[model samples]
Target chain A: MSAAAVLAVVVGAAAAKGELTGDPKAGEAIYARCFACHALAYNRTGPKHCGLLGRRAGSVAGFEYSAAMKRANWVWNRQTLDRFLADPLKAVPGTTMGYAGVKDRQERADLIAYIEQAGRSEVCRAR
Target chain B: MSSRIQSPDASLSLASDAPNLETRRSFLGKSGLVLSGAAVALLAGRDVLAKGNRPAGSDVNVLNSALGAELEAIAAYQVGAESGLLQKPVLNLAVTFQGHHKEHADVLTKTIIKLGGQPVSAKEKYTFPVETLKTQSDVLRFAAMLEKGAVSAYLGAVPVFENRDLAKAAASILGDEAMHWAILRNALGDAPVPAAFMS
Candidate 1:
């Protein structure tokens, strides 16, 4: 109705569009759940997840795992991990991983991204 | 635009026997008000972030402690799974517990990294809770206690996590941990929600 009001609206829209998006830092914190069972080392808790981006499941060392997991010859990449984390039982019927997977897609991606970074860290390499 | 307005007025008079310009204008005005409100909200959100008053990080050590506790829980569950003491259902539950702990460890590790620190690696060959758990009932009871401890630990650590998302994540996991405890309680033939504290 008024020129001042229209100008205000235009300015507001511009500001809103410039707002910061998702926080990788926050995503990093959200990734702790994966660290327990999946490690970026040769052997930590459940398996050595180092360089797991394209690796297969049940391939980690020294971990006496369930037969269900050992049978899944699938690779551990972003998309596969996302689906598996979304619903572990649904993704692999007999897999021993009992925990329900992460429900959020963005969170799953963030967790995977964090793991990718962690896998490349010096400590991970040293291990 | 003028022809359109005239056509609408003629149709209104023909259909309702009365033209309602006032009602139509009021409806448009109400919608304008709603749009203005939305615009104001958008502006306010931008101003808040522009003020550079973003949330702060929580106490790092408390998060580390939480990670440590989760590590312990994983060790306990893995041992239980291997001891041949757990039934199929219980063994499945243990595996699930392991995954949950792994998720917790991953999040905590990221938090530590965000704060410019390294996550502590869990020690190999952790001491099991075998001495404390002797029977099937005892294993269930021990799990319930462990879950309860996790819930309380998460609650206590919530205040220390400065990041709102981190705090919410902790709360979310704590709720799930409580659920796991309830499930284990029911499996053991106890009330899902314990009447008294396990401690």
Candidate 2:
């Protein structure tokens, strides 16, 4: 089957399971794209996502945020994350983060899963 | 042509969509008070954390400049949307983008007031590249250029804030502006994101 078909099947099954279906292991590989600018422990090119799931936009300590982001009311959630990952610019227009964002839905889902898992780990929690 | 290029008072009447007078006044009053409080705090040798470690009155200037840029973007999108050059879909998109700029302007105004500075009022007129927006392609290209400049503007300003909070705010705005540029570039048939590093 084509990649698209496989993705559809996976997504459908995940939806049927009534939960997010991305594998954190798979997500770790997908995270390589983000690892350049983001880290679990501290702010870099972008702010750290160590505790990102519920944080408001521009709330990270010591990170330089754009005016648009500082004033944004968005809170991180699965849906918001998906929207942002799908198209960072479209999700938030004035943001300075250089990455275009993950285009593939499965990749984004996996990436989010990895972030969630890694963020809660003792390594991230200790920071 | 030179007159048009340099004229800061050219009629780009978008007053209906712009923030109202009362709102501007309220913002100015609030921001002024906040700055006064910060100044008092400084004199008392207390560090005002909310003001971001910058000098008492400085944040107003930074925020006003940002507000001015947002107004410029609003004007640019207004002109493009009214130019009759874009198809329906494109026109709709332009309007939506305009709304986003308006939101940015509103937020900046509020932030300025909260930080004790008056929000910059919309210009009486603006000098847009009206002559160049004669075609659909020209219009999109112009919008993209404006978005690109906005991204750079925010990026430059973000790091200057002594307050990490303000820095984070500026970074957030930068992200949105970058997004706008990416979308416009995509509309112009360029890659949505051309490089790993946006700088």
Best by lDDT: 2
Q: Indicate the worst ten consecutive residues by lDDT in candidate 2 chain B.
A: B1-10
Question: CA shift at A98, candidate 2, in angstroms?
Answer: 21
| Model 2 lDDT tens row, B82-155 | 67898866776676677667767777776676666667676555556476577888998878776776665566
Off by over 4 Å in 1: A1-127, B1-58, B195-199
lDDT of candidate 1 over A12-62, digit per residue (tens): 874585522233466566654443344345443346666777877877666
**Cα lDDT for residue B27, candidate 1:** 86
- Candidate 2 residue spans exceeding 4 A from truth: A1-127, B2-55
**DockQ, structure candidate 2:** 0.02
Residue-pair clashes per candidate = 19, 37
Best by TM-score: 2
* Reference interface contacts recovered per candidate: 0.00, 0.00
TM-score for every candidate vs. truth?
0.43, 0.47
